[model samples]
Target: MITVTSRSELTQSDSAPDPTAEPQDGTVLFEGRHHHSGVTFFWADTPPGSGPETHWHPYTETWAVIEGDVEISADGETLQAATGDIVTVTAGTVHRFWNTGAENLRMLCIHASPELIEHEVPQD
Candidate 1:
């Protein structure tokens, strides 16, 4: 099977906020449910100082920086990823990333699930 898609052809979705971090306010490019690939892909255009909260997924997740630099916090450690850099988080690992550069940060977030399953910390 073969498929093709462009960034401009993707639909957008708003991000929800939780107690651990601010709302990402990004777009969903190719949700795993959109196809039968068993994986979800999305693009995050995070302005300076905004990103997803501390959360973990049941499946592995990866983030590839496309435009600007991003500061990723994984399991209490922080690292700066620049354009073309990719960061991976194993299943059940706590992590979050945000724009750390002056310009808007564009990154591709991929998950190993058909649907995006995000578990925010401190579940009440």
Candidate 2:
């Protein structure tokens, strides 16, 4: 079966930039309901200095950095990744990522599950 979803159809999460808010920092794009068979793919592009907040998933997620640079923080330690790099986060691992380069960061996020399930880390 084939399914197509546009970025606008995605449900906006608190971690994503609010277009209604001034000085938007970044954005998050999620796959639609059709993602529930085997695997799911979502696209994300963050301007420099912006990205998703800390969160964890019950299923594994892999990120393919298509452009610019990103800094990934997993379980505590952080590492810098650039274009052509692929970052993988195992299931239930707390993590977050940010665009640290001077340009907009583009990435393809592949999820082992068909649907998106996220548990955000609470702020102190």
lDDT of 1 at 12: 42
Best by lDDT: 1
RMSD of each: 4.2, 3.7
Q: For candidate 2, lDDT tens digit of each residue in 5-33?
A: 55666555422334354435344545444
- Compared with the true structure, what per-residue lDDT tens digits does model 1 show for residues 1-124? 7677666665444233223444345554577576557888767778898887689999999888899988888898998899999889999999988788998888888988887788888735
List the candidate 2 regions with Cα displacement exceeding 4 Å.
3-32, 35-37
Residue clash pairs of candidate 1? none
Evaluate all candidate structures by whole-model CA lDDT and list the values in order: 0.77, 0.76
How many residue pairs collide in each prediction?
A: 0, 1
For model 2, what is the alpha-carbon lDDT of residue 11?
56
What TM-score against the true fold does each predicted structure earn? 0.79, 0.77
